[model samples]
Target: MAPYEVLYGRKCLTPLYWTELSEKQIHGVALVRETEEKVKVIRDCLKAASDRQKPYAYLKRKEIEFQIGAKVFLKVSPWKKILRFGRKGKLSPRFIGSYEVIERIGPVAYRLALPTELERIHDVCFMCRCCDDIVLIIHM
Candidate 1:
């Protein structure tokens, strides 16, 4: 079993290593058990793997070989208010439009040349490619 597997609550052990734990500190306390030394080894391996995992920001920057005119989509994230909070009625728009890559400012942000109609709401929406062909558009 991988180290992080135990952290994620996977059936990653022999019956001997399994033990009931309180819901609050379920995984945390389970990891401290003296008997599960082997499991601890697995946990260590998993932790190493997790630590080695690239950060979201770094991963997003690797998405595209940006060209001056490559077509790409912009993603909008839902907003939540800290005070007087209620769900915004409008469903968050997905794949709003395919805008051309006008210029690359930094790894994650780009200068996009958008339509004049969308100028009021958006002219330059910063993007981060979190996954393959998927850019998370950050409102600036």
Candidate 2:
């Protein structure tokens, strides 16, 4: 059986089985046992695939850790908080604030000390937007 059938607990009807009919003799406890075995096999295969692909996924990625009081710029997602009161969002800067990191909520989330002006938005933000150096002046 394919992994799809094993995980989803359903038989896949493909062109290979177009002319075949399901065996009606297998029933009751036997059918339940068969399904259980398929589920076990599916779990093992999924874990193996994840282990094999994990290293490649992190090849070029660098993990960044933020400490309390560290300054970071909050990314401006156009969908998250709309700023189109009167001006166009395309003309607005893509990022806002060099806010200080006030608290760590979880492994990947942080709470920033946003200004009173930005009290409307949520305090918690992901680490992907926590950049230290806003811009390094490159001397031409």
Candidate 3:
């Protein structure tokens, strides 16, 4: 039984049947055809929406890779009342380095030669958090 039949003690009215109808009044073959048509229409609409969204989802994304010994700027997240590398405030820089890439830990992670001040923090960072020093010119 459908949830509506269990909860309200009656079958729910669908788009095809706004009024209550007995099982004898509806034919199985016709109901199956209508349901298949509705499902096809819903699937087509979902595909259209997904296609329209695909380009924007990848607009700013590109494959990023770095070799060992390459220089990169590491992105930093600021926290309230907590200092990072002795810098704090709304005006502080969002990224720090030209840190050398010591090793490529994985496809998307790189280990950097961070300064002694940042020894407490982990050295491995994802590609998104590290920007190539050469590409920094494009933004300027």
Candidate 4:
């Protein structure tokens, strides 16, 4: 069944195909009250569904926090047929630099001490673009 049919308790009808079938018709105050009741039922159902799914949506989410002066690697994505950080293709590095966090701009944003090569790009980046673990080798 369509979602509209289930929620509204009736199939949606186009104006061209619509016809009055019942001899008795609801009018005035009763019609208003009936419409309000249907709207209330739909709202209740929507709220219930949202509550049930909220937990599952947040199940894998972890709140990350970074401190000032901590080292973090910046994640970089290289586009196809384009050069990024003087490198391109499948063999290009996924992440670059263990840049130091100069300051925490907000809960999820931090200012990094980016190298001169990345001067054109913004120094501040979101927490999702950074990783605290020293996984990549620092070839200095």
Instruction: State the C-alpha lDDT per candidate.
Output: 0.58, 0.67, 0.70, 0.69
Query: What lDDT score goes with residue 69 in model 1?
Result: 70
Residue pairs in collision within model 4:
none
Q: What is the full ranking by lDDT, best candidate first? A: 3, 4, 2, 1
Off by over 4 Å in 2: 1-22, 76-78, 81-95, 105-109, 128-140
Q: Candidate 2 — what's its lDDT? A: 0.67
TM-scores across all candidates?
A: 0.37, 0.56, 0.46, 0.47
Q: What is candidate 1's lDDT per residue for 1-140, written digit by digit as tens?
A: 67768688786656444655445554555466644676688899999887778575467555555666766666544552211133355544544556778887765667777777556545456453334466555342
Q: Model 2: per-residue lDDT, tens digit, 53-128?
A: 9999999987667888987767656664354333345765455667788888787678998777678777886434
Estimate, for each residue in 43-79, the C-alpha lDDT of model 3 and write its tens digit.
Answer: 9999999999999999997768888887777766676
Worst ten in a row by lDDT for model 3 = 131-140
- Please give the range of 10 consecutive residues that has the lowest summed lDDT in model 4: 14-23
Runs of candidate 3 with Cα error greater than 4 angstroms are: 1-55, 80-82, 85-90, 126-140
Quick one: best TM-score, which candidate? 2
lDDT of model 2 at position 117 = 69
Clashes of 4: 0
lDDT for position 37 in model 1: 76
Give the Cα error of residue 28 in candidate 1, in Å.
Answer: 40
Q: How does model 4 score by TM-score? A: 0.47
